[model samples]
Structure formats: structure tokens, C-alpha cells
Target: MITKDIQVNCSIVERFNSLDSSGRLAHAYLFVGPAYIGKTETALSIAKMFCCEEKPTAGQLFCGQCSSCKKADSSCHPDINFINSDFGEQIKIEQIRELLAQVRLRPFMAKKKIFIIKNVENITLEGSNALLKTLEEPVGDSLLILTTSVPEKNLDTIRSRCQIVRFLSETKQDLAEHIRTHYKEDEITSQYFAYFAEGCFGKARLLQEKKWFEKKNEIIDGFLFKGWNDDSIKKVLEDKEQVKEVLDVLLSCIRDCMLIKHGIGQNSLINVDRKEDLKGFADRFSFDELVAINGEIIKTCKLLSENLNLKIPISVIKEML
Candidate 1:
């Protein structure tokens, strides 16, 4: 029997299985969706179909007990390759050249050679174009799986060569339940972090981490009650990623405050953290004034990322209130 616990997208799974049944699977596939939506997992599942020794008896897929499946699980499959980079650095032309050179060779143990590339967007322009050529004329039994959080960041030429399978963002309830179950958090916190996560497990994991909770609460309190003071926001600003997240949290909270001013319920608020904090602001600022502050957040977040004077925006945002 074919069984999967991880909410297998039935339609997508069907299409993939049908392709294999007809012996007409595409050479390249683009799995596009928000980060942490299991795009990588789905690609790995499909790769198993190409390499698994024990074929699925019920459906079109690899049996979990196969040696190839074990190899994939161990991340040491000779015929399967996975690569990603932090920035747009790893997918350069040099890497593409070497990978393309290898793709031409026959598979060692499996009938198919599979290359799974993560962060397709980070593949530089020259590298993407180079990849486009191989994608254009794929080897007879080779499959390439490209996964990206931002497929739009990749070159159109590379995108045009692949069949795109889109993953839907999980619901807050579903995602939160999953996190709470696996992460072992209190119910209220699980719900809180779920809403705060905005439907991304990667973000949820970061938000739910105990190490960050105290710091995050302190930051939220800093914005909610404290004067828009230099000493307050400056603490988080010390860390680039923390600065970005705190700013983003502020922007989102202010948005909630605006909605509340316009008669949106607290129940409807998106940021699960510090709703009372947003309420505190909504009580102090008018809807229009809150909106103006929200606009400042947009501008400030941009400037901060561009390495602009952070203190200036912080002062400006405070002064706007």
C-alpha cells in the first residue's frame, strides 16, 4: 500500500505518478513555493522513484525499504546529487560546468542520474544560462529537480525549460499543530508562534526556539510600551538578522493596530505575539497616524537592508508616532 504521512499533495503526486507510468517524465522540474513548504522533500521523493531498488508495488514510486532509498536517506547516493548555497555564490558557471560534465556520464547503480539543486534563484545569470543548455538537451535517463523559494529570481530562460509544480502555503492551524507536536510547546505559544510564523515552518522554527523567545519578547515589549528610544531598538539592531526580524515584527504589529483602529477584532490580528502591545499603540495613535508609521517601516526596512543609517530611520519612525 502507498502511504505518506506528510500531507502528500494528491494532485501533484498523481501527476508525477502518471508521468512515470507513461514513461514520459520531464527532464527538468521546477518546484516553486515559499521557503520551508517541503519543496525540497517532494523533490527528494521524486528522485527516489528514479533510483529506488524496491519499486512501489501499489503506486508509481520508490519503496521505502530499498537500498537506493536507504542511500538517499543517508545522503550518499552516487547517482543523486544535491547542492545549495547561502548567497548566489555556489551556482556559478564553474559549478555548472563541472555538474554538466558529470551529467553526461551513465549512472553507476541506478538507471537514472538525478541532480537536485536548491535555491534556483541563487544561481547566477551566467550559471543559469549555462544550466539552461543542459536542461535544453537533457540526457536520455536523467532528471533535474530545481527548488526555489523565489523562482522569479531565476532567469526566464532557465524557468522556461522546466515544468513547474507549485506548493501551497500551509494553514496556520495545520502548521502550528505540526510545530507544537514536534517542537513541544504549550498550546497558547504554539498558536501564537503559528500566527507569528505567517505560514512558514522555517520562520516558525526560528520564532519557537526557546533561545529566541525571551529575546523576542523583550524586543516586542521594547517597541510596545517603551518610548521609541535609541537604547530600545538599538539592542536588536546589534544583530543584522535580529534587526530585520524586529523591524518586520514592528511593521506587522502596526498593520494590526491599523486594522484594529478600523474595527478589526483582536481575534483577527495576524501577529500572534504582542497583540496587547499593538492594542496599546492603537489606543495611542489614530488610524491615519498609525498608517503613516507603517509607511515609515517600509522605507526604513529597505534603507536598513541597503546599509543605510539605521539610527536615522529609527528616529524618524519614532518621531512619526
Candidate 2:
């Protein structure tokens, strides 16, 4: 069932199902949440509900036995279109123009044509401007579903045209329980993932699948002990996605060091497992050095978001360290 595919956002799911059941669905819906928080999965589930030939009678997921449901579940539905840009790339104006042409066509099988665009924030300025008309006035049998991790980055004109649905992050307890039940993990392992993920199920799953937790710890240790060099910086910043992850982990480790320096409780630290190492690093850096490093990290993150180079910002952080 589609609901089984969603590990969180139960309330939002129930409300959407009710709306669909009553035939009062919105023409457009903006699903907003943090990265790896099931926004895409929930959006796909809603799409299934809309496409299902035998819709759920109660406030539940679509009937899996129906032909339409099976097709949608398998991602082979002709009427449903999934649009997303390549990693670290914007959705170009050409893509939006293509989408405009596709939306004019009638649904081949289902009653409505569904378009699911993921990471709408990555839409270029020209692309967003081109998309505004359809968002404002859609065909009766067409539905648009947009999902984004950064809502603030989207145009206000576009956001004002659609209904917004916020997906709240789960509590540590709830997240841990979900991981324990769904992933078939023991309590301790589940708790670790839940804490490190900070309430995002997809992130927790990724961390487990990629073993990033240990890898990130190793990176932090290398940065603190061996210190940053040209070769190390080059290797870490090689990939765009890896650069983001590395920067995030580096920032967290520095934050943990700051907490230790301030005599803050260990519970507030993001890298709880590396508390002792963080403390040792904290002693080496003066308060001023830590502050400078933190400021550089903030700047680096902003630069990265704007598709700028990371070498300089990263090098500055290294100099401060």
C-alpha cells in the first residue's frame, strides 16, 4: 500500500486522502519540507490516490488491486509524469516549455493528468516565469504537484498560486520507533540513526545504507589531527554532493567543539559520538579562532547554495583551524 511507503506525515496524508475522497482536491499542491523527509514519497502516494480506479472508501491509501493503482505503483502510468532536474542542476526554461505543451494534451487513460515535479526550488528564473500561467489557471482534469526542500528560494508569485502543505519533522522517539519497526533494527542502532538524522527518515536510511556516520567521523578526525592540506581539500571537494555532506559534517564538528569550549552540556552536540575528540580539538583553538571558523562555514554554505566555488571558503576555514 502507498501508506506503507510513507513512514511519516500521517496527518497530512489523511487530510489529502479525505480531500480526494470528497472530490475536493486542489488544482495544485506545494509539498514543502527538509531534504530526505519523505515529501516525494508522500507526493507520489497522493498521486496514486488520484489515479486509482478504485479509490479508498475510508481515509486510506489507494486499492492496490486496481489496474490503475498497479500501473501507478510500478511508475508506468501514461497520464502521470515525473519531472526532475539532474543533480546540482536547475530545471531549465526548455523543460518548462515542454511541460506546458504536455499539460495541454488530454489524459490517455486516467481521468486527470498528474505532473510531479521534484525540487521545484531548482527551477531557473525563466522556467518559473514560464510556469506561472499554468499554475494560476490549470485544466480541470489536470493536477500539478510540486515538492521542494527550500520553499524560500521559490518565487512568491508561484507559491501564491498553490496550496502549501508542510511536512513536519518527527521527534527523536517517534523517528527511532519507526526505524526500529520498519527497518528491522534494534533499539540502540535505531536510536543512533534517529539522533544523527535529526528526525528525517530518508536521511537516517541514507546514513545507514552508505555508512556515512562512520565516514564523516573519520573525516572530522583527519581534519582535526592531520589538519587540512591542498590534497585533502581537493579530495573532499571533488564531488558536488559530497562537498555538501563534508561541509555539513565539518560544521557540526566545529559546533561540537564550540559547545565543549563553552562548557555546554554534551546533549546539545550534534556529533555526540565524537564528544571526547571534539573536546580535545576545542582546547587547541582559541575562542576567536572558533568564531572565525564558524563564520567561514556559514559563508561557505551560502556560497554553495548560490552555485559558487567552495575552494576558497574551505581554504579559509582550514587557515583558521
Candidate 3:
């Protein structure tokens, strides 16, 4: 789809149009935002607009019917390439080398060749330096779009060469509406999905598909009152991905509970799906206890992200409870 079709803040769209229209668009562009919040889609739209055969009418973006747009959107165009690791993973040295080798060649159909590198933060130290030369002296016809959840990891020099675009996500209500438009979810369940997504539409869709809110609430409730037992942890370990998602949602829940205890009001709770139970537990647990629990959850999540032993963290959390 074209850039105009995307539902994002107007400031971002306006900035892109201004740059592209004035012919001042930078060769290396950095998209700063959280994960699963449409960064990839926005980058793809930019690639399509750059590759469009005809300049689109004002306010209208790349025409999807055009050959260039179709090829780019479908990711079949030789000129439009996505540089990431195997299995849509990281930005590795090999991927960067292959991208560098490809960009040296001429465009297949479009006037310019575009590279969309997802998660620029994942670019290795070696890969970053390798891409540095390309970013320093662009072929004038080649464009690089780098998307990252955390832009701090990118080298300062690399960031200076690029035009940074910040993508703000929709509010809870907005995400809920998008969910309702695309799915058959009820109002309550849809709101829960939005709350769990933490204002990320793409994440909202995935959690909606998995009905993760249901699992999240169940897990939190079990942890508070019933507490986690061997059989319960065993069942959770059965699905590692869902277990990870559940832990993330659980951490958010504890954070909300902490806020509520500090008198932030019920509406401010991210765990709105079970505000009463969460508040009750928050009241039962002292402020220090709640804070410590939240810290452990966050620490555990961080360890998991680094590919640590999951059992050890879970065991620590169990003991803390």
C-alpha cells in the first residue's frame, strides 16, 4: 500500500512529502520507534513512493497499480531490496556485504534503487562500519531506509547522515477501533487487546489473533492469588513464545498495579482487564513488594531477551512470590 493509505500522525507524512517534493531527501533515513508499530510498513511505503513510475498527484501516494509500485510492494522488484538477516532476524555483516554488492549495480526498472534494513540497532559493529562507507558517499540514485526500535545503538556519525523519522503509534482507542474493523472481537476483548498492545497496532493485531489478553489475565490472576506452582509453570513452559508474551504483559500489569497503589486512579492502569483483582493484590502487597516484583519481572524479561536460561529466572520469580 502507498504512504497516504497508512494511518499515522500527519506530521510524519507531511515531513516526508516536504523532503521528497523539495528534492532534499537524504540517502540514509532512520525510522525511530518501538517494535511492531508499523515502521516496516512505513519504510515499504517510502520505498514504493520512491520507485513509483509517475509522480503521484498531491496527497495521493504511489499508485499500487503501477508496475514499479506493484513490484516493490510485492518485494519482487530487483531494484527494491530488503536487507535483514535470515528468518527476518538481524542486520549481519554478510547481509550488509550482499546489500553493498547489489547497490553498486544499476536499477532494474525504477529510477532509484532502495534498501530497507529493519532494526538498524541489530547491525553488528562490523556491519555498521561496512555500511558507513555506503552511507558516506551515496550513488545519488540509491536510498537506504533503516528502521530501529532503539536508535541509540546506531553510531552517531551514521545517524547524522540520515533523515530521522519518528513514527508515533495510535492511542488505545485508536488501536481498539482498528481491531474492531479487522476482527470479530467484542468491545471488551478488543479494548483488552489494545491495552495489552501498549499502543502498538501491529502488536495489537498479533495479540488479538492469539487471544493473548485472555491468557495474560489468567496468568496474572493465578500469580496473585493462587500463585505459580510446578504444574502451572510446566503448562506455561509448553509454549515458549506465548510464555514470553505473557511475561511481557504481566510486567506491564505489575507496573500498572504499582501506579494504582500510588493513587494514579483506576483508568491509568494498563491492566484494565482485571483492575479490581490487580488493585486488590496491590493493596495486599506493600509498595516495596510491588516495586521489587516489577523489577524482577523486568530483569527477568531482559535476561530472556539475551538468550539466558529461562528456568533460572522463573525459579527466582517463584521464590520471590
Candidate 4:
């Protein structure tokens, strides 16, 4: 689905439009960026544009009323295919073979068949080799779009074959403002999603849908402020998904305390709702101590990303306090 506000990813669409207008569209494209940053959405939008029966010009977007647009929007378009890979699982060679076979056929309806492979970095080396054959030989009336959060994991040959498009992340403030204005969110709600989502609108929307912001006070007060007790850590660790959320909140709280120590304006603080409490916490530590704590928190977060044992990192964080 096209996101509610797509201005953040308009550059990709504009580039595609220019290419389509000039009749110079590439056979394959690689859209690389952080997860939930609109790479897939942009690919889907471009796919719809390619199939739009209205035949929009360079400056115009797809007409929603067209049969092709309706089918694409409803995910019923035969010519548009989305191949999704689950987390931690590599795309199989059989999947690549199926994709190759499908791409060999002519479009069922539209002028071109579009295949969007999400998380292409997860493709196994064998699968990558199979996919490479198709990329080497341009298939008839087909467009291949591959997306990956970690471009470094993708094969260099595959990367070289496609026209690479790099997506930039939005600023926290800009995202907060967008959420507040477009979603009719309150200032705190808007700021919460923006900070937690790390400037990704799609992530913000998912967090909102999950009502994750409701846990803000509980998480901060329970584990963060009191220096992550055994019970608090246990609760957080029980749900592996919440591990990152807890770390993000802990990092933000520490940063807020640092800001409070420096007498920074309240508006600059991420956890603005807890300004008074953070100020009190800040007074207990020296500036250098806070810096050290911040470093530990950053280190722990990195270790967690690498799938290291969380207990070791948590123990180190506990010692920091």
C-alpha cells in the first residue's frame, strides 16, 4: 500500500517518472535503505505507474480510477508480483527459479510485468546466482526491483547489474511534525513515534498500530530510571521483540538526562514528558559520568544487534550505574 504521506520518498518516484518519460527505464533496479523507510512502497508505486492504463505523463501521478490502478491497489494485478522473505530466512533457489520462469513470460495485461523482491539481501548465494542469470539477460517486458536494508550483504555482481537507488532517512523533527499534522496526533504522541521510529514514517505507523507508545511511562519508570533491576530486565528480556524497544528507550532517557545536566531547553529533550524527573536524575551524576553511561548504552545496543548474549551487556550496563 502507498503510505499516507510519501513526500519523504518523492525523489525515487520523480526519478522513475523521468526515466519512463525518456524511455530509458532500466531492466533492474536496486533500492537500498534502512527498513521501513519506503523503499518497498516506492517500488510498488512505480509498479502501479508502469501499469496505469491512463498513461500518465512525466509530471502526473497514476490515475486511481483506472482498472490497472484499481487492480494494483487491490493487489489483484497479474503483472505485478511481490516476493517477500521472512526475517532470518534466506530466499531459496527454488524461489529464484520460479521468479525466473515467471519473468520469462509476457505480461498478462499491462505493458510490462513488474517483480518486487523484498529483502533481497536474504537471498542465498545459490539463489543469487540463479537470479543473476535473469539479470544478465534482460527479460521481455519485465521490470525487476530488489530492496535490501543491508546492501553490504548482497553480492557485488548483482549490485553492479541494477541501477542503485539510495534512500535517505528523514529527520526526527520533520517526522514528528508530519505525524502531528497528518495523523492528527498530539505533540507527545507525535514525538514518541518519531523518536522511536528513528525518522521512518512506516515504522511510526506500525508502532502506532501496535500502540507501543502506551508503554513509554511503564518502560522508562520500571527499568530505565532505577538502573535496570533484575525483575525489570527479566520482563524486558521475556519478549525478544521488546529488547530493541527497551534499548531505544534507555538510550533516549540517558540522552535526556545529559541534556538536563547541561541546562538544555526542554524542547530539545526527547522525553519531554519526564523533564522534571530527568532533571532530578541528571543532578545525581557528573557530566563525565553521564557520557560514560551513554557510551555503555551505545555499546550494548551494538552488541545486541550482532546477536551477542544480552546478559553480558546488561551486566556491564548495571555496573555503569
Candidate 5:
């Protein structure tokens, strides 16, 4: 049901247009960036362009009204195959074999066959080996597009075979504008979410969709006023999937407190809505205590990354409090 009407960065669009117009488009492209940063959308846009029935005029890449564009937009194009980890966390070798067989054939409708592989980092060693052969010698007029949030996880050979296009996170101004126009939020609220997102529009959108501000405020109130305890830790750890987000919010609150203690302006703080609460916390904890706690939180994050038991880090966080 998803569509590809969302506009990507203008610079990326221009770059692709230049390559396509010059007839220098690479057979393989690796789109690397953080999650929800339009890596897949960009790849799909290119695929749509390749399959578009009508030629695009200057400054326009694809005609969205064309039949080819409609098919690509709806993800129903015969020549465009989307491979991902829908079956499991790791893309298995069986899927790779099937893909190989399909790519060997010619396009059914479009000028070229486009294969979009999402989360290439999750491809197993066997699958990567299988894909290596295809990448080494791509079939006639076929295009391969791979997208990954963690490019480092992909094999060096795979990285070498593809033309890497790095996608940077959105700027604060861009993110704030998107939020204001899409989410109908005020300037201050939009800016706060923009800063909190750390230039990732996808993260900002997810936070808005999840109604994260209310939950973040509750967590901050409990941590600062109610104090840390076993129950408090349990509440934070209730959803293991959201642990990182919760930790990020907690870290931002700590940063706001530190900024307030140092006489920094409220505008510089991400938790601007809770400036009064931050001021109180700033007065309650010494600068040294705040620094030590911040260090512990960072350590906890590292431990979590290392796959250590979640409880261990949560307990350590409690002790720091």
C-alpha cells in the first residue's frame, strides 16, 4: 500500500538525473544511510525513472501519472523485484538463488530489470557469496540497488562492486519545516522534535506517530521527581525494543539539566517544554554528579550494544542514579 511520492533530497535527485542523462548510470548502486532517510525511496525513484513510459523533461525525473510509474509506485512492476528479510532476520541463500534465476531473464515490460535488495547487511555469508557472482557479471541492461543502514556489516567485496551513494541526515531547518507542514505542530514544538531527531526525519516522524512527547515527559518526571528505584527501572525496561529510544530521551534530559546548570539558554535545550523541571534538577545535582551519571548512561549504552544482559545495564543505571 506504500507509495513513492515522498520527495527525496534535491541534490540526490539532481545527481541521479545527471548520471541517467549522461548514460553513465552504474549497474549496481549501494544506498547507505541511517534508517528512514529515503535510501530505499531514492532507489525506487530511480527504478521508476528507468521504467517511466514518457521521457521526463528538464528538472523532472519521472512522470508519476504514467502506467510504468504507477506500477513502480504500487510496487507491482514485473521487472522490479524487491528482496528483503521478510522471511527472517537474515536473508537466506534460497531467496538469493531465486533472485539470481529471475535476474538472468530479460525484462517483461520495462527497458531494464531492476532488483532492489533491502538490508543487504542481513544477507547471510552464503547469500553474499551467491550475490557476488551476479554483481561481478550483471546481465544485460539489469540494475541492482542495495540499501543498508549499516554499510560496515556488508562484505568488502560487495561494497567494492557497487557504486556507494551516502545519504546524509536532514538538517534541523529541513526537519522543522517538514514537521510544521506535515504534523501541524508549532514552531517551538517542531524545532524541539527536529533537534531530538538528530537530523533523521524518519526518527522524528516515528516519534510524532508514537506520541512520544507525552511518554518522554512522563519518563522525565518520574526519573527527576519520583526518583529511581526497581519499579522505575522496570517501567523503563518494559519494552526492550524501545530501550534505546528511552535511553536517548533520558540522556537528552540530563544534557538539558547540565545546560541549565551552566546558564545556557533554553533555546539550546531539546527539552524546552520542560525547562522548569530541568532547572530544578540542575539545582539538585552537582555538576560533578551530573557528569558522572552521564558517563554511566553512556557506558550502559555501550554495554547494551555489546549484547550484555539488559538487566545488568539497567541495574548499573539505577546505581548511578
Candidate 6:
């Protein structure tokens, strides 16, 4: 019932299949991993397996032809509930209360009531407490699945009640092949996307669709190459929402320069397309300087996320550069 024909985590799939075969699936599960690695999709697939009208066999996870599978694929299944933050805000206690109320009821059409909470790390303290109550006294024929990129941010009590499933990031080769297959891009371009994505498929796809590399090039040309100055830093920091992404790109560029300084192969560099420029830039800074700059960029990113004054970090980075 997973509509997206993308590659899933085989280990998790095998685990789910084994659980299905033995009928020993847990009441609560936590899918923890980096962003864009398809934790939500895996959760949905499990939901489909639970709700499918035609019982899936060992090999076949879900019978896509069934009515339940169809509904699940379209996210219209009555029993499958998805809870997420509203408008980039935290999931409130009221939302958790409503979910708890609904979970107490029996399934309308499916065999079980499945609740999938996305960005579980964003659950407020009160909401976490409300969810914890349900976790402690699990309802019959009910499944709770929580997905989070930042599992460390989740409350310990909530995390302890669920069966944790760790999802590792995809390999660059696998991600590149996925891009080549789905986006119809050539191997070189796909590899480029894969390198910059840092093992995140969703980020690779977004970069491809949005032409983010072009934007990255503009930033690099104006800020890094043209020279690190007040105007260039100001231009990069203008869009607070994009500051993290800009910093990531800058980090990649600096990483590439370090690689060049250490005489590493260009094939392993994230900024493969700009090897010459990176090489030239590498000469200007010592290896220690590159490492220090990378650290500074990371610190700036952390500061920006804390809602600190944007100019403060930018100024620090300017001085570092």
C-alpha cells in the first residue's frame, strides 16, 4: 500500500515481515533515523500490513489489490490515524487527548487502530505525558508508531515504552542509483546529488527538483570565492529559513577543500563539480584552518537553531573565514 515505488530499509522490512509471520508485532514502535530516509514510509507500510483486507504472506508484505490497501495507499483509511505538528508548531496536549480518545474506540473497518505520529520529537511536555499514559496502558488491537529524526530530544519515559527501530542512512551508491532510476538523471549528476545529500534521499530529490545546486553555486561564488566580507555574509544571512542549508553547503565546500589539501581523490569530494576552484581555495587556508572553519560553521548552525541573534553567528563565521 506504500504508493511510492522507492527502495525501503531492507532490514526493517525483514523485521516487519518476520513479525507478521510470527504474529508478534509490538503494540508500540519508534522509528528513529536521519531525515528523508523513509521512516514515515516504513511506518505506513506497517500500517497497511495491519489493515490490509487480504492477509499478506511471508514474501508479500501487503496485497496492494485489497480495498484496505488502496485506502491506506491514499491515506484515506478510517483506522489509520496520522498525527503531526500543525503549521510547524509542536504537537499540543489537546491533540494527544483527542488521539487518546479515538484510540479507546474499536476499529471501524480495519482489524486494528494504527496511530502514526510524525516528528515525535516535537511533542510538547504535556502532550508527551498524555501519550505516555496510553503507552503504559496499551489498548487492545491498537498500534502506536512514532517517527523522529532527533530521537535524543524525545522524553525518556515515552521512549522507554516503545520498541526502538534504528534506521541507518543509505549509502551514496544506493542513493545515487535511486536518483538515476526515479529522476532519469545520468550517473554523474545523480552521484553529485548523492554526495551533497549526505545520505539523505529526500534531500537529494529536493536538490534535483529545486535546482538547489544553482543556488549553492551563486552563494559560493558571491560569498566564499568572491571574498568573505560584510556584504557577502549579509546576503547569505538575509533568509533565516535558508541559513541552515547555506551553512551546509558552505561546510561541504570547506570539506572538499580539506580533502584536496590532504591529497584525497576528487571522486570522494562532495563538491566534485568545482574541484578546481576548491583546489585553488584550498591553497589559501591551512588544513587546521579548514577544520576550524568547519567547526565554526557547525557552531553557527547550532546558534541559529537556538533563535539567537543571526548576526552574532554570522559575525563569528566572518571572523573565522
| Candidate that would win on lDDT | 4
The best-first sequence of candidates by TM-score reads 5, 4, 6, 1, 2, 3
Which candidate leads the pack in TM-score? 5
Count of backbone collisions in candidate 3? 0
Q: Better model by lDDT, 2 or 3?
A: 2
TM-score of each: 0.85, 0.79, 0.79, 0.90, 0.91, 0.86
Better of 1 and 5 by lDDT: 5
lDDT of 5 by residue, 104-137 (tens): 8989998889999998999999999999988988
Clashing pairs in 1: none
Q: In lDDT terms, how accurate is model 2? A: 0.81
lDDT of 4 by residue, 52-145 (tens): 8896654566766789998998888999988888656778999888888889999998889999999999999999999998888898899999
lDDT (tens digit, per residue) of candidate 2 on 1-321 = 346665546667668768876988888889998888988777777677767887576646677678888898788988888886544578989988988888999988877888988999889999999999999997767889898888988999989998999888899999989889888877656766887788999988988898876787677867767776689779978777777877788888888888888899976777777778788889998987888888888889899889898888888777777
Better-scoring candidate (TM-score), 4 or 5: 5
Model 4 pairs whose backbones collide: none
- The TM-score obtained by model 2 is 0.79
Q: Number of backbone collisions per candidate, in order?
A: 0, 0, 0, 0, 0, 0
Model 5 ranges with Cα > 4 A deviation: 1-7, 56-58, 86-88, 227-229, 312-321
lDDT of 1 by residue, 54-169 (tens): 74787546777878888987889998888766544567788788888879989988888889888888877788878887899978678898988887688888889999888888
Error of 6 at 305 (Å): 3.6
lDDT (Cα atoms) of all candidates against the true structure: 0.76, 0.81, 0.76, 0.84, 0.81, 0.82
Cα deviation at 264, candidate 5, in Å, is 1.0
Once fitted onto the true fold, the runs of candidate 2 whose alpha carbons sit more than 4 angstroms away are 55-59, 86-88, 92-106, 124-130, 184-198, 226-230, 237-243, 285-289, 299-316, 319-321
**Which pairs of residues collide in model 6?**
none
